[model samples]
Target chain A: MTDTWLTSLITDTPQQGYELAITLSRRGVKYTQPDMDTLKKLRPEYANSAEGLTAASHVIAVNFQTVAAANNYWRG
Target chain B: MTDTWLTSLITDTPQQGYELAITLSRRGVKYTQPDMDTLKKLRPEYANSAEGLTAASHVIAVNFQTVAAANNYWRG
Candidate 1:
């Protein structure tokens, strides 16, 4: 959330990179929906549904793709 | 996490698509780290750090890109 955090996206390992990706994704949600109460209230609507859960995975895969690209798929 | 949840990635609106992306990202973390206690224990390490937070945004942007593509950026 802080501009100061805007440094290198470079991660030492894929595992670390993946964890970072998840962190980024989670924070994105927090930023989008700042209200914890509202987030919780909305959770049930999506959390219990199959469509909602699948949608979540789709986002994660997309995020992972970006992280992997940033890390050059960790080929190095 | 269930195979049965697999279905069309298509979404009606950008807002809905975005919400789905967030869900996918979240579910990814859950799938990766099933242990809630471990996940909670690791939270502070990244949640409080500036770099961690930014990393989170980076991933979110990446995810948004994918969702946008799926929704054709809602041009219709």
Candidate 2:
């Protein structure tokens, strides 16, 4: 099976997010982050760190599926 | 095979970033989002869009590997 990985920062309307999520699901991809509070609860260490705090403020809280995918996106 | 995905905002030293990258690589996780300029070059649409601009400023340009994994982390 093709590796399903993504590394794009998407910031748009809830509609857009929902649409993307749907697309991801159809492709066997999945959304990561839940609500903000829950994220904090999950990553307690990061939850208390500066990175965590910064992530919260900027909403940079999505992870990539694979390093190659992330590298490609980052390199592009 | 088990799916490998991520959905966490990581902000730390370049060392930490590198370390994480290495870990991801070993696990077959890839990193997306090249350098700022390159990213802009690749995603011109997002580059010109407000969301793209915002992502640039915040550095929230990573994708999730799997929905279940992302959901687990966010929920935790």
Q: Whose lDDT is greatest here?
A: 1
lDDT of 1 by residue, B23-73 (tens): 676566778998899988977654554344334444556666676666555
The CAPRI class of candidate 2 is incorrect
- How much does each candidate deviate at the interface, measured as C-alpha RMSD after superposition? 12.0, 15.0
Residues A1-76, candidate 2, lDDT per residue (tens digit)?
A: 3465545535333223323433453243123553567545665453333333333323322323332233332221
Candidate 1: tens digits of C-alpha lDDT, residues A1-76: 2233323345789888777656556657576556577556666655686866665555556666656765667896
How well does each candidate superpose onto the true structure, as a TM-score?
0.47, 0.20
TM-score computed on alpha carbons, candidate 2: 0.20
Give the range where candidate 1 chain A is weakest over 10 consecutive residues by summed lDDT.
Answer: A1-10
Local distance difference test, candidate 2: 0.36
> What are the chain A TM-scores for all the models, listed individually?
0.73, 0.28
Q: What is candidate 1's DockQ?
A: 0.08
Which one is best on DockQ? 1
Please identify model 2 stretches exceeding 4 Å from their true place: A1-76, B1-5, B29-76
